[model samples]
Target: MVDSLEDTIEEERLELMVSPTGGDPTLRIAHFLKPSVTSIDGPISNLPLDAHSFEDTIAKPNIWASKVAFNGWRNPQKQWKHWVHHMHSLHQSTWKEAGIHEAVMNSTFEIPRNDNLIFAFAEKWCCETRTFVFPWGEATITLEDMMVLGGYSVLGDSVSSSLKNGELEQIHEKLIQAHLQVTRSRARKADQSTWIAKFVDSGSEIEHEAFLALWLSRFVVPASSAKIVAKVVFPIAVRLSRGIKVALAPAVLARIYRDLSLLKDITVKMKTLNGNEDDDNDVRVTSLAPLQLVQTWIWERFPTLRPNPHLIENDAPRMARWDKRKKVNSENVRQAINSASEHFLWRPYAMAANGYLPCKLYKEEAEWMPVGSGLDEEVSSLARCVRVSELVGLDCTEQYLPHRVAMQFGFDQDLPGHVPRGEQTRKIAWENYTRPIGDTVLYIPSRLFEADVTKRYLDWWKRSIFGGHNVTKTAREQRSSSESLKKTVLHISNEKKADNDLLVPPGFRPKCNMVEVSFDDDDEDKQTLAKLVRKIPTESEKSLSRENGKPSLDPQVQSPSSSSTADNGTVGKDKCHVKPVDNSIRRKLAMEDSEKEAESGTFVHDSVSISNKAESSSLDACETPGLDLEARIGKLEYAVAFLKAAKFGHRSD
Candidate 1:
């Protein structure tokens, strides 16, 4: 029956994995078609790669070819493998820094000639610093030796060395090229920043300034590229002020404490509905003890192929849909890979000719693009874990999108959906428009947002706005209001000059000294100096001179002053005192002294003493109220003496 089934499959459920080289092309067989092309144990009786098998009937219960019926989609995995062969065939580059070279590449890792040297070199750079530490899966770097890059450099005796050393031999085959550098992390002082403000550091000055220049040439050039990038620096600044962290990663990921609770609930609900009676006790469970031999065989071949490089929904075998639920034709799967590749190429190709990107972009591209199986990274990432509920036995009756959050979820049951009402099925959208991929990398950190320079600049250029503006910015504005203001002010802010800016008077040369000038049409603004001049006194009226207590009434008078006595009696020099009477002219001095003393005499004692004092003073003393009070008392004393009124005839009036 098995032989009959093999013979029976003609063209009905079959597809081509690779595009046929010659002939009808329509006659190509099922691809990704894991025939016994490479065998582990047995002498393969009927290999699928045979020319005869191309036209002959094959033994399989189900299969499909990438005929027009499959929408011209080829098997992504098969095509991917097919590519690896071609790529490997053309690849030839020798590297010798760490005993790695082209001839020994398969043993260590082969370098395709076109592979980016910068990307290859970057690993060495990263090797120098223990500061930056990415877990194996974080960046574009393939996780082989459990290495991380792009943060603080490591200390010689740091904890990271312990983590990295154990896995070296396993990845002895892989090599990447990239450029990395350390920045001057010292905070600039206000005094030092003054120079930066007057003449800031140029793109040619920063250590990575050259790298930045290269990125801008390729990715952010004018009129040549196709890609999209989305950044929200200002919005991020606003959110950061509210205390969120890591703008590249979402708030939820950073605040894992909050996430763990929801994750716990989800883990519970998923375990329940997805549970089936056949789980550990399915009747179809046969003694796969036969496969135990195969499993052990594959396990022994460690450094060859990783069993689960893509560690998310589909790649992780435990999380994958049961073989029965996989309805996509193998050929259709390959086609998906092809489409993704073409999509990936669009940005790099568009920006490649421009000088902004490094020559090494293509280099890294070669290193990263392995079999088409590796290309599914776009859809298969752990970042796409949100889509996990849809792929298989996952019963998401309870699970919904967690990112489409409009507002936060106050309760546990209603998870904040990221999608809005009008676009319920769509992913959450940014409220603002973004710039093209090319224009974005023109700035410092904006391009840094991406993992590779190629993607960094290419993505940025594609995201440029309509007017060739690369408005998308680098994010994760890390501080609060005061700190943020300081950070942003370092770059001159784009504020418009106010009308009051011109209001700073241009010298003291006005047409007239205040009150003399009045005009009907001058109502437009009341701030002209002529009108405000008198209300505020001349400099002389404001201060007294020490030379004398009186102020000089001249505009250009020079006396902060030694003899200026202000109306309030404030004096500058002369030990800061009031004008004193001159005893040399006793009459005038006495009159003045008497008058001055009278004004301070309230309604009280020593009235006769004032008489005696004032009578001895000059007439100008009468000008002083104390002198008048003294004069009146002197008259009353004389009248009392003349009429003897004080002794006996006193008048109460």
Candidate 2:
């Protein structure tokens, strides 16, 4: 027990000496930090000490000087045992001063906003140790740095007695810097990830500007809004980097932003809305990096290629007509466009937040969204009425500028193609998502990755049996056989190969009019009827030879069944060998089938058209003699059939 106690005392002594220089075990630990923090609350404009009274004692902007002093110092007394807790306390101070805390920021986003908003987020901390030490001269101290440390010091000598509301005392500058180095050294010990290393390492820069912005946006002034950062990049770079060409990148990048074209008319409306014509609407700003340059280009071009087909139909109704020279098939383009417009070109972020996922938001529907250049309408559409706040995941009722800005700061962090991982990432969303899966996972939260970027496609129908069209409860279904329609109208009718240019050739369907050669069926009706059938787009018609009135969709299209050719192809090429299926009688049978179809609401069963006449059991309808007489008559009929075959040379004479 004595040995263990001695070992602990040794450990404590060495730990206390961590802030001192010259890495030796025997050096005395300095009483570096003894502080009594007056408080960490109230507006930036007002200070605890009256400036008039302290005018001769302090420098101009005493608060600013004190902050500079605090940054330069740390606890010389070695008060904090946990290194992480020490780092956390320093980080809290940064956040508080950087306007991350609410009281420091200006109400209007106009001016006087703190520049380092991210570093200002204050944390809850209390030190009941009641330690106090005021720095006198420069053993390892600057007046500014020492004054800043006083802002967080606990006063008095005992833990309970010095538990005053506030006190101001100094901390050693060496200890403060030493603490940061220690944490970074520990972070590098085991292999920590890149992001983790940055957070722990003092030398590491804040790579994610958006994260800082998001935290600070809630309280910072509006001058540093995402929009403004977007604009001032060039000049800001010029100031920071001192390079003319680097400064010009923002302008070049800005020009690349085609939203300028969208901004022209919007500027006018914005000016009117704000009651200020002098407003510089041309200055569209954002903190998003240059990668967004490509995204901006795509956003501009998408509106053209992905315009609602209905818009073209309404504007230039003839746009849907077939144009062979154009590489894109207009109808297919129409379907995809209509689908895209309904799905917002697969950008379901704004819509996915809601329950529904209709494919596109059409131009007519989008008219309300206040999109792009030129003022054609007086009233704005549904898009403009929408607020960025609704998408912010929380309410910002009052004017807390930093927090608001912070909310949007993550915009730049919404990295393209970045897949999020981890528990919190799983429970909520931090990455782009895909379509829903089953009842539990109904919605995907990912950004709208382009289809080309999606990398894989799967056959949707093969996984499940369609059963039949009636199985679907969806209302959009119709009796149209779209699959068959394409083969007939597109490939066969135009006589084009499936892999070739779009027109389907006529060899597939030799005759569009399967009508029998009886007049009074007007030519107009025949043309109209042909057009209707051709419009189906899938029916692959071809040269058909048949034994009866039924038309077979066969050249090589139908099955090998012998009964298939009994349809609309030329029937009975020879009278000799046929089983004597009377042509008129077969036609009469077809008429009866048609009547039954009409009465039953046209739900024609598969057997109705496909069954052969030989399969029909209509014995009672046919005239029959007595049993022995009927047998003799059947024999005579067979003999007659044999004689007819011989006469036509169907059998050897």
Among all candidates shown, the one with the greatest lDDT:
2
Tens-place lDDT digits, model 1, residues 157-191: 11101113333322211100011111122322212
Alpha-carbon deviation at 422 in model 2, angstroms: 32
What local lDDT score does residue 605 receive in model 1, on the 0 to 100 scale?
A: 23
Cα lDDT tens digits, model 2, 213-266, are 211122111122222112112122112111111111112222222222222223
Q: Give the top-scoring candidate (TM-score).
A: 2
- Looking at candidate 1, the ten consecutive residues that score lowest on lDDT are 484-493
Give, for candidate 2, the lowest lDDT window spanning 10 residues: 121-130
Instruction: Please report the TM-score between candidate 2 and the true structure.
Output: 0.19
Model 2, position 22, has a per-residue lDDT of: 14
Which whole-number lDDT from 0 to 100 does residue 498 have in model 2?
40
**Model 2, global lDDT:** 0.20
